[model samples]
Target: MQIVFVGGSTGQGGSPRLYRDELSGDFIVQGYLVTDPSDLAQMKIPDGESVVRVPRSLFDYLPKDDADGVA
Candidate 1:
């Protein structure tokens, strides 16, 4: 499956980025793992699925329209 870079928040390490699956048009997010007990308890996380935390600023880089012709 082909993947394309979407956007990322500015930082020293430059993490917390978004990516798109070229074939499926599904989004893949890269961010810090949410392992806090209290936070984890609030959500019904299924097996094989983990939560990730990302800064609100990351959404600012998301495209308003279909930019990569994936839609």
Candidate 2:
């Protein structure tokens, strides 16, 4: 699936980056749970159904429009 980095900064170094699937529009971080967007070079397409540890703070940086039910 095609992935796009929705927000956040790649320069943060070890800071986790958010990625969105261009096809499914599903947000993913560290692989498992669908979450948000990323930098191209440093990103890896998530595989399998195993959940990985992700930084909760990354959610705050996602675009408000991407939320499931804010309206």
Candidate 3:
């Protein structure tokens, strides 16, 4: 089953919203995960992968948009 992982920006009281829904009752999260070792290098961003921790209260305020994805 798919799951939603919501996160926030670098600051400014914002958060990232992830959608987790199984349209066909076979939604998988791991299957959708894509790994690109050169992602940061190509984007010219930090190369180090870091973990982000968020409080439950902040997560409750995360926005939820059910709009279609841009593919």
Candidate 4:
């Protein structure tokens, strides 16, 4: 269940954060449109496919080195 912050869009209002699951290779986005994993349940994604949402605070959990890279 290890999650890693990936990247996000720099759109007008605010940028949404993106995350990736190291174990499942799933992508999670926080902000706008899709706000929760259950939001995609109706999309009928593949059996194991996952597109979820996590707290913005998750960004603070990134490794120090990774955080430096983003800056």
Which structure among the candidates has the greatest lDDT?
Answer: 1
Kindly report which residue stretches of model 1 are placed more than 4 angstroms away from their true locations once superposed.
Answer: 11-14, 66-71
- Model 1 alpha-carbon miss at residue 10, Å: 3.9
Output the better candidate (1/4) by TM-score.
1
Kindly report which residue stretches of model 3 are placed more than 4 angstroms away from their true locations once superposed.
1-47, 65-71
- Residues 1-71, candidate 2, lDDT per residue (tens digit)? 99876555445544467778877767767423534443323556556533455667777766686366121
C-alpha local distance difference test of each model:
0.81, 0.59, 0.38, 0.60
lDDT score, candidate 4: 0.60
Task: Please tell me which model should have the higher lDDT, number 3 or number 4.
Answer: 4
Clashes of 1: 0
Error of 1 at 58 (Å): 0.9
TM per candidate: 0.80, 0.51, 0.24, 0.37
Query: What does candidate 4's lDDT look like per residue over 1-71, in tens digits?
Result: 99886765554525467677777766566665554556775687777555554456646644455443332
Clashing pairs in 3: 7-16, 8-15
Name the lDDT value of residue 33 in candidate 2. Answer: 51
TM-score of 1: 0.80
RMSD for all candidates, in order, please.
Answer: 2.9, 10.5, 12.5, 9.6
